[model samples]
Target: MRAIGKRLWMATLAAVLALAAAGCGSPASNGAGQGDANSGEPIVIKFSHVTTPDSPKGQAAEKFKELAEQKTNGRVKVEVFPSGQLYGDKEELEALQAGNVQMIAPSVTKLVGLNPAFQIVDMPFLFNSREAVLKFWDGELGQKLMKSLEPHGILGLAMWENGFKQFTNSKRPLKRPEDFKGLKFRTQAGKVLEAQFKALGAGAATIPFNETYVALQQGTVDGQENTFNNIDTQRYAEVQKYLTVSNHGRLDYVVLVNKSFWEGLPEDIRKALEEALKEATEFERQLAYELDQKSFENLKKAGMEVYELTEEDKEAFRKALEPVYAEFADVIGKEFIDGARALK
Candidate 1:
């Protein structure tokens, strides 16, 4: 009788343990339990940028983050790494291509180095207006340019507006072609921009946007040229004093994802992502120029001197940099540059 009682107790303990295990293994125990109703899961994504959260690019990134999360119904979690917390433009681009970073927001200047066709977007004085740029980018030619990125293991999601590039520095406000003399400015890591700066007789240095603040603060460089949105967003107001309305360069920003990650997404998720990107791009473009104008006004209120260049000055400025086009036409391809110009 004692032996039978002991055997019965052992059997009861085994049964109880089995029941407990089943309960834990079921979807009810955690998110992955079998009975749980969640068909998909939340994936954490790292989105990196080189501007502050207040800039147009930064703000748009924030909007994209919110939209992605909401559209995915909490299935996708996007974490914005604004202000280059993760990496700078070049480093971030490499990381994205390698799948180390899920997404990134880099300017067209950075893309030009990755593919020569991207130089079309960087062509000096090519785009007459934002509408023209949008048309060109959303057109067949733009799609062709985007397709080129696929070979490098990157998927171009959408194009975000970054406004127009202007000149700013601590030394003086640029008012004419002569005003550009000896101005040591920080330029992006693009050949075209560097050529333009050199033509202006300014000693141009390639510095990452993230490090520009500290570099300027330490007197490592005199001043830099970027969009009003970027200048305002990065608080360039704090480090520099003069802002010139040269509007000499275009600021075409791109959002990219890893090709492998993009390809592996389910068809439903992929469609959802495409829709989300389009919505975000449209919203960004509409707000970008408006914010740039606001940033200019805000900079003056912040005690910075602003120079409004005369038409003659603007013409001279344009003339001085004209050689930039011909010089880089070979690398940028004469055919692409001429076609972009002929696009109307």
Candidate 2:
């Protein structure tokens, strides 16, 4: 009887020890173990933007999806949503913050509400060429600007170019600063932009990007400003009779990801995505330049009167709108504005 009791006790002890060993080998044991929990499932990244698939931004999003999957060996899956399919210009930022989406590339102008300093990019004639803008974005000032968003649960990865902004008005040709007076223009939401038109003695209306075409067609606004690619893609030429290559401002986007989501990524996955983005960014800029040239020709063929502003004309417009700098210096930071100007 005593021998049978000893055997039973030993068997019970062995069972308990086996259970403890299994727990030690479980997925919660360490970071690698945690990763094992979803090892079979690829991480999904929903990349959202408000541009057509053929646009520079849209193409780059697709390119990123391809490169990311290839680089991560299917560990990462990027699903791109372009042309506001998921969220429009006004709603994308909110969606990213809420984690309903993992990524978005919104125009810098859209970020003014979050940080007024973002308006530095919207300053008229602040950047003369794409190269100068790239220089600014790759410099110390740009690094500081990107870091400014971390406190808001946002991470700005890179600045992508959409080319320079031009004016398209149905009322008349805009060769002179006075040509913009009394005409209301549709503009992205920002105080600097409002002040831009105001300085020219014009009225500015804040309108959603997707709604810009209808607003122009219905004569709700006399004109709007955007890159040539945007003007061509959105068919703004169909409603507006004149296109001025003012190049007064640039329309660039900040590639953003959710702060928490980005930080939580596995180190290997994060490094691979960064490398992929760097390559995609280079491709997007070259595409932007090509599309700008192509779109300019297309707009002319579309029967819109195209006017290229002379150096003198641009200077005149610049002088007229100079007060905008003084008006927002405090809000955008004098040093910040000065830093951008120094780049030029």
Candidate 3:
């Protein structure tokens, strides 16, 4: 009788313990048992990009990281990997898609393969000033472009500026359209840029960003175009001689997050991130111009011959490339081009 009573008690205790264990595994538990809202393990966000920590894009990434952690009250942590520490320009997107990283800010031109509409900003002389660029990007058209990325498992947070592009060459001063004749220029891997340079009677070659400086030095290519900050930071002026302030096109970056990761974020954390993005965008945009000017000053000291175009001179170059609009109309859409042109 004693032995039977003891066995019955042991069985009852086992059943109660099993029920308690099951309770801990309930849906109320954070997915994967990571944590819950009131008390759980902190979330980790890994942001990766391909620029130095001092560049506008890099600075903006750091700013977002700082703000995100602060606003989330330490519940969220953002780890930033700049200068391709995590992945190069070509691999960053793939990493994000695989969920290996949570976020990226790639050059807008890099998105051309995903959606041709992304190259709208790359249209030569498309934006005449910083204000106009901001107006278009912060308005309906920009939002529409960003939304186009959602179906691709990516979410765009904001449009960050890399300032305007200027031309540099070792052959001779490129002050006029005719000056580009027969000169080989390295260009971003975008059809629009290729069309723009070819229209000027110049030869265009697509080279990886990492290989450009050596290419320029060895005469593998005659020249390249990029923002002043890029030229200064990368020390391109050391290899190239003349700098022409073309402002021909803008180099813009789109902040992106893994769509699933973004959507799965706690609602409050997501809102905080969005708010942090807005603040970082403003800081990056303003800092871009300031840094560009400072870079030009530094380049001048480096003995680069800088040239600015007169209104008449600019109009001539603009007229020469007018055919580009018709050539790319099918890819960029005539109506979309018109809409961007019409922005205030």
- Comparing 1 and 3 by lDDT, which wins? 3
Q: Which portions of model 2 show Cα errors greater than 4 Å?
A: 1-38
Error of 2 at 70 (Å): 1.4
Candidate 3, position 8, lDDT:
100
Model 2 per-residue lDDT tens digits across residues 162-255: 8889999998899999988899999987788889999999999999878999999999999999988889989998999999988888889999
Prediction 1 global C-alpha lDDT? 0.76
* TM-scores, all models, native as reference: 0.75, 0.86, 0.89
Better structure of 1 and 3 per TM-score:
3
lDDT of 3: 0.86
Cα shift from native, residue 7, model 2 (Å): 11
Per-residue lDDT of model 1, residues 69-184, tens digit only? 78877767778888889897659988887666788978876787678768666565676566777777787677777788998998887788877777788887778777778878
As a TM-score, model 2 comes out at: 0.86
What clash pairs does model 1 have?
26-33, 27-33, 27-34
**Candidate 3 segments exceeding 4 Å error:** 1-38
Q: List the residue pairs that clash in candidate 3.
A: none
lDDT of 3 at 214: 95
Q: How high is the lDDT of residue 174 in model 2?
A: 93
lDDT, model 1, position 127 = 67
